[model samples]
Target: MKSKVIQKIKLTKDPISNFDLVIQAQKGVDAEMAFEISETLLMPDEDLSLILHLSTKTLKNYQKSEKSLNPIASEQVLKLNELRKKGEQVFGSVEAFNNWLKKPAIGLDDAIPYQFLQTSGGMDLVMEELDSIAYGDFS
Candidate 1:
């Protein structure tokens, strides 16, 4: 009889599966991953602080210590990654999506989408708006 060693592999592909995201969230998101997300999204520390509900001082400490974000923050980070993908798909490019985020949208009550990235409910509303645009229901 041969003994088999089963190794768990973390998913590193784009658009990670929901199950994998849940697991990753539970384990917490590392500083490197947070940095990657910020870089990819062109988000400044001030914006990130709002999303994570953490003070700028704490965020700096986390960076200095190479800490992992808590589960709630980790989950928010993962969701933001998904939102980035969806935004890119809808607008045809990251640049276009980012431009859209900066401008006020009529459907979003003339509010800039970037301002809504702070909370889960606001993120969902943005996602809904994206879906509406993608589906040609711009009204």
Candidate 2:
């Protein structure tokens, strides 16, 4: 039984990169993995729920389910993974990236970047800001 449990845990991929996980997430990753990915991204349950447009009870249900996320939810998770991965890469660490997300940014018109990850257009704006940061454009 223990070995079976271990094997079940091992069934999940150990992704080489966050983007790799994003690919998995887009294709309907297991619900448990969604929680794990949220942790990996340093996202609070509230943030994740907002990003997913899901209720807290829904998230709790997903946590308890043995099934994978539906296509819509999976795509949301993918978007989140993209943002978290890009943030970490750009800021060089999760700590710096999360800090930047919380702080107001001039590029975002003084809005917190992390809150924008809840939607695609907002995510695009945040991505553009990160791109500018990466290229030293800042404009």
Candidate 3:
């Protein structure tokens, strides 16, 4: 029974957002897979930092929160709203917003750093695929 449970857990994918960050940070998931996943989860003009921060918060809550309806969920939602406000303040003008959008998806080497990629065995596969795509191996 224990082995069966473990196997089921192993087969399950980690939350899609974590996979996105691992690929983005490592520059290593397959382009198609990454693009598809990103498209599904992110709006075309979404701020990478905003999505990343939200994903990080969501993943943290999923792992640690008592349940979906816990106070932590509300707190995270509030924090995200606060972050959006800060983003607007920092990138007040349309030009600033455009420039920010044009910037590389992963600005800092540690923006969506390696430490966050250590979720499980599957992450390495995600990294490998991302690396290949970044190198134009897909074509």
Candidate 4:
């Protein structure tokens, strides 16, 4: 009789703010079998309205298609492709571009957040960060 291996793993990180909780998990029996998990435990009824509003907005965006995507978003996708091509020319592969695209758009909180005005700040911040990196100004 052969014995099977059982492995378990857990990971966790503190929330960015005192208002929330963050937890993560990973498990695997071998290199071939693995799983990951993440959890954000929100306070009971803590700004439930805001959470629902944000969720609804995200669902709407996720439902959007190439045809339904706003002009700006469509343009952004095109720009991303262009940048991807440039990266391929320099790096010899589009792996970097594909990796970037595969990332969840969570950092675009301002663009995705529900409020028209409040979200702009976040988007602006993200754009500024991108610009700084693009201009070779790491400071």
Q: Each candidate's TM vs. the true structure?
A: 0.80, 0.74, 0.26, 0.26
Best by TM-score: 1
Cα lDDT of model 2 by residue, 1-71, tens digit: 43243234324333135464455545565556567668876788887788778876788887786666766
Model 3 lDDT per residue over 17-112, tens place = 444333333422222222223343232413322333435344444435422322322222222222223333444643443343334334233133
What C-alpha lDDT, on a 0 to 100 scale, does residue 115 get in candidate 3?
A: 30
User: TM-score of predicted model 4?
Assistant: 0.26
TM-score of 2: 0.74
Which model, 1 or 2, shows the larger TM-score? 1
Can you write out model 1's per-residue Cα lDDT over 18-130, one digit (the tens) per residue?
Answer: 79777878877765566567777889988888898987788778878878788888887777877888888888887888889889998999999889999988888898999
The C-alpha stretches of model 2 lying farther than 4 A from their native spots are: 1-26
Q: Residues 1-139, candidate 4: write the lDDT tens digits.
A: 0003111211212112212101111111121111111011111222221322333344244434211223333222222223333334433455543343334334443232212212334334434434544566432
Candidates 1 and 3 compared by lDDT, better number? 1
The most accurate candidate by lDDT is 1
Q: Please give the distance, in angstroms, between residue 87's alpha carbon in candidate 1 and its true position after superposition.
A: 0.9
Ranking by TM-score: 1, 2, 4, 3
